[model samples]
Target: LSVVQDQIDDLKISLNISLRIVLIGKTGSGKSSSGNAVLGWSEFKSDLSQTSVTKLCQKAQGRVEGRRVEVVDTPGLFDSTMSHHEVNEEMLKCISLLAPGPHVFLLVLQIGRFTPEEKETLNLIMKAFGKDAQKFTIILFTHGDKLEDYGLSLEEFIQKKCDDSCKKLISDCGNRCHVFNNKEKDTERKYIQVRGLIKKIDDVVRANGGGCYTNEMLQEMKRKMEEMEEKFKQEMQKMQQRMEEQRDENEKVLQERDNELKELKTNIKRERTLREEEQKNCNLFFHNITIIGPYFQKCAKMNQSFAQK
Candidate 1:
């Protein structure tokens, strides 16, 4: 009886285990709705917008089938409005939000609406997250209602209507895929889909030897970010230092100019003093000449009158 009880306890613990999942895809790929569906609640904002709705990476937690699940919703990759840098920052943020690492990456795609952008979805994901992320990825197709409306199973749609690239994407993901009807009204049906998804997630964790995607890549990316940040800091510091040095050099040049100007003013003042003294001496000599010339003229007149007598 004790052994049976121990086995039951172990099963309960397994059922109650936690899961970390991230949803990634292009804009308008139903990532937000899919995240809400997985949580079995409307934790994420779902809407129809011409632009990407979830602009940042956000995390929410809930219990699905008695298991704790963490869902990280991210903005649309390759969004026209968002720059590549913005997307990378968000990707890093997603990595951090998942903390240690995510157990699965749900590459969400919309059924019957494959476009050119959607074709590069997987490649973009691998580029942003890393190549190894593919091993932990699961292709999640939303808008299952569309498939239901056309009376086609998910697999049937893939084989009949999906293009070669789409098929290749599925094959690359190891044929692991699931469809979600986010608008379903029946609780039991929603539960079944979510349960099936959880089962797939369990399989992935098991295949990985019960390990989540390692933090090695995340650490490497972070180290790169830190390096970039450090480099930027160094560049800014060098620029600032150069500016300060230039300012000091300019100040020194200005000081030299000021000193030269002061010396020029002093020389001008000395020259002016000398000119005044010379002018005074010339005026006095001219006055003495004027006085002596009159005296000599008077003596010459007296001598001439005496000789005539």
Candidate 2:
């Protein structure tokens, strides 16, 4: 019995699942940089630019400490270049990429550059994902070197230096946070930070009972897409049917007009023929009257002379 139980436990251990992580943040928050750091190499482009570097949802995967990890980098939530509809579409696209869904969402933030959009990020996430999004979120602060330059620990900065909104954000995320210094060239230190981040991720997964965060919003979007496609097909069919019906009706009308025109032409020709014949008859009668007029007069004179005698 002991041997059998040991074998079962070994089988269960081999079933350790992979991690699917999605990054969310405002533009210029070093989301791409953090993703590269997590994967211990560069899989996404990172740079200093006023414009958003990522315009679409992109996914990259690698092995971290012998565990499979997938990172999905998304466009900034409040990028000015993108409209509201466009941003929502990209987010939905991100959700679709991580179908059935992400085990954790790393809410990327800069060390000391929290803006108004950053403050409203949680609200947006709730609006997009749901209220339960907070449960599966982990706050990830990039540019750790800045915090080091300030000579402040992560906890100290949160308690003393960070603004009220930032503090509230951290609190809301259950104080589950990690910092990454992408500029750190020391492989050991980078490895340590990545390992720590992964540990927190494992904790989040455990807390959620080994289940990923699934959103009804994703399912709803899919349903809407299907409905719209079906509606478009139906509309196209109706338009084609209407066009075909109109074409047949036009042909019928044209045929009737053509028949009516032919009948009118025949009637006009008959009337012309009758008029010509009547004119001819009148001309003949006048000619006959003119020829007999002289003859009649001579006959009348002879009859008068005979009576006198």
Candidate 3:
């Protein structure tokens, strides 16, 4: 009974364990096909077009060798003619699809098609995703038929055909690479490739402390967003304070003006009263002068008559 219980418990634990992978690359680099091959089904749309085929991110879930596996297929990272904003938006969506994050990033590359543009795209991926991405990244090469045509193994191809920068990129990824031939219909080959890829992913996970790839760029973005929110809050507070101060200043000015108006009115009333009093005195003086003038004239006339007599 104890042995049976332990077996059941182990099975449960195995069922709970899952592997998440995110595929990223430029247009026509066979990312979608590679994803389908990895999942052992045609879950993602694969095509050979002059333009980008995968316009959005797609996620597919499956069980491989008793392990739950989830693969995220993303649009080409750096499609020519796409604006930076558009690319960034799509990349952000890819990250969101990965949710908490991915266990490994499959940087898809075409076998024998490494160009200067592809090199630049790789650099862009490193720059945009951050340096930490390399720790959990695997350089997945698609179109493995190219290797057969050249009669070379993957190692031979990388050694002879790849340039210095390409070699460095592989080295940076810890030389973690795998080749898949999506065109091949052999079930055994497919199984072997998928198994090998999953094993490599397991190895990477174990080597990296059993943790998924840490999205430092995403974390940094979150931190920056928090800072921006804080800044916005501070600015709003400052604006509110300024508005309050302006209101108080305006009230003070209005109060001062009202006080000045009241003083002017009082002065006007006082001046009017003084003018009235002055006018009354002037009237009284005018009346007295008229009567005295008449009296003086009569006295002068009497004196003249007495002198004549």
TM-score, model 3 to reference: 0.65
Candidate 1 stretches greater than 4 Å from native: 1-17, 220-309
Which regions of candidate 3 deviate over 4 angstroms?
1-16, 215-217, 221-309
Best of the two (1, 3) by lDDT: 1
Kindly report which residue pairs in candidate 2 clash with one another: none
Clashes per candidate (backbone, < 3 Å) = 0, 0, 0
Global lDDT of each candidate: 0.84, 0.84, 0.81
Write model 2 residue lDDT over 27-69, tens digit each, in one string: 7888998999888778998767757888998899988889888
Residue 233 C-alpha lDDT in model 3 = 98
Candidate 2: C-alpha RMSD to true structure equals 11.1
